[model samples]
Target: MGDTSDFDRFYTDLKETEKKDSVLTSKQQIDRLLRPGSTYLNLNPFEVLQIPPDSDVDFAKKKYKKLSLLIHPDKNADDRERADRAFDVVKKAIKMIEDPDELARCRETYTEARARLAIIMSEKRRKQKKDGLGDKIPEDEPAAYNKALWVVVTKVFADREKKRKMLEERANEEKRRAAEELVAAAEKRRKEEEFAKNYEESRDERRGTWRQFMAKKARKEGEGKSLRGTAFRPPKLKLETSGK
Candidate 1:
């Protein structure tokens, strides 16, 4: 609705005509969401809502409500678990469209996908033009063109998904590495503290032992000097004069 009307129109046609040919029903989408290896596939909110990424917020809200009601656990009791999962995805999609930054990201992906398809379509048309045919959806081969367009869409989605997974994996790896580093740092600090504590205790014990040894040495030296001075005294002559 801002300055991307053409892009929005192309996306609308892709979903309504070509995309619908692949069945964009609530049940069908829910099945896909629950399928194995769908974690990355479900990252695209536009695909989750089965609508154009550039859709108005009001339209997206309406779609969310419709899909939520269709897949709400209270309504689908028999398949409640899968239905709940699907409902959660729809709710997440609603939130994504409501968030400005996330909405921009989805829009960016959609724009890139559109540009890729446009390039492929133009090239095919150019080849046709060179072959003496007009540069448009060939009238004689509507089915083939539609198939070609479908193939392009599938490939775009696949490529987008692959890139999304790579980025996600890289982010997770960084987080894991950070956590490991944090733990390692904590352990290193603890060991250093323990070593410092042990060193302080050992140092105090050595100081105490050195002080005792010096005290004993001083006492033995004083005893030896007293013995030397007493043994050198002239006592025998004084005893003889007292007897006489």
Candidate 2:
């Protein structure tokens, strides 16, 4: 806050730490690649390549070659597994840089960061002026501006990743539900077909049972008529006359 150069000094110290990565051994590079926060950090291809986002694809390709060699599994046979993973990370970053759409998105993220940083600096200047403090903004320095830009860029990438994951999950859920509905519809149709088949297969048996019932009823009626005709009347009329 006292001197604008202090901000520059702070930014310089951070860059110096990053510069040390260039000379790191293969083991160290693997460790850094697979570090605790690497998942979040690796969201930015620029961060993975250790290059500025504004760099052209050619420059990014060159950087990728150097980083790839540093962490290549063939170069570090003792730690091949980790080195292979690190190598994959580098490969993905280079692929993103080569892709026109992804490269454009990366550039847009940097632009957004710059725009957000500008708004923040503008607000800070406003507050300082209102408080009668001289309008000297530390982030006006190139180093300080870069340092602030880094923060905003990281945030933008993270937000984008979060939203992407959410949308993906939603789409997967919809697909699952649609698949289940298709299975249910197929099952319903199968049951209906099975019922129709059974009904058709039993038609002949039902007709045979009906014919047997009708024949039995006719035979009983014929036997009743035959009994009535053959039944004896006896001499009942003559006995009744003698009693009278």
Query: Please, what is the whole-model Cα lDDT of each candidate in the order they appear?
Result: 0.72, 0.85
- Model 2 per-residue lDDT tens digits across residues 1-244: 2476875664465466478976777787787678665787788999888888789999999988888988899999988988899999999999999999999998898888889988999999999989998788888898767788886887888889899999999999999999999999999999999999998999999889899889999999999999989969787555344554
lDDT: which candidate is best? 2
- Candidate 1: where are CA atoms >4 Å away? 1-42, 125-158, 208-244
- What is the per-residue lDDT of model 1 for residues 46-66, given as tens digits with 9 covering 90 to 100? 767767656988999987787
lDDT of 2: 0.85
Query: Which pairs clash in the backbone of model 1?
Result: none
Q: Which candidate is the best by TM-score?
A: 2
Tell me how far candidate 1 lies from the true structure as C-alpha RMSD in angstroms.
10.2
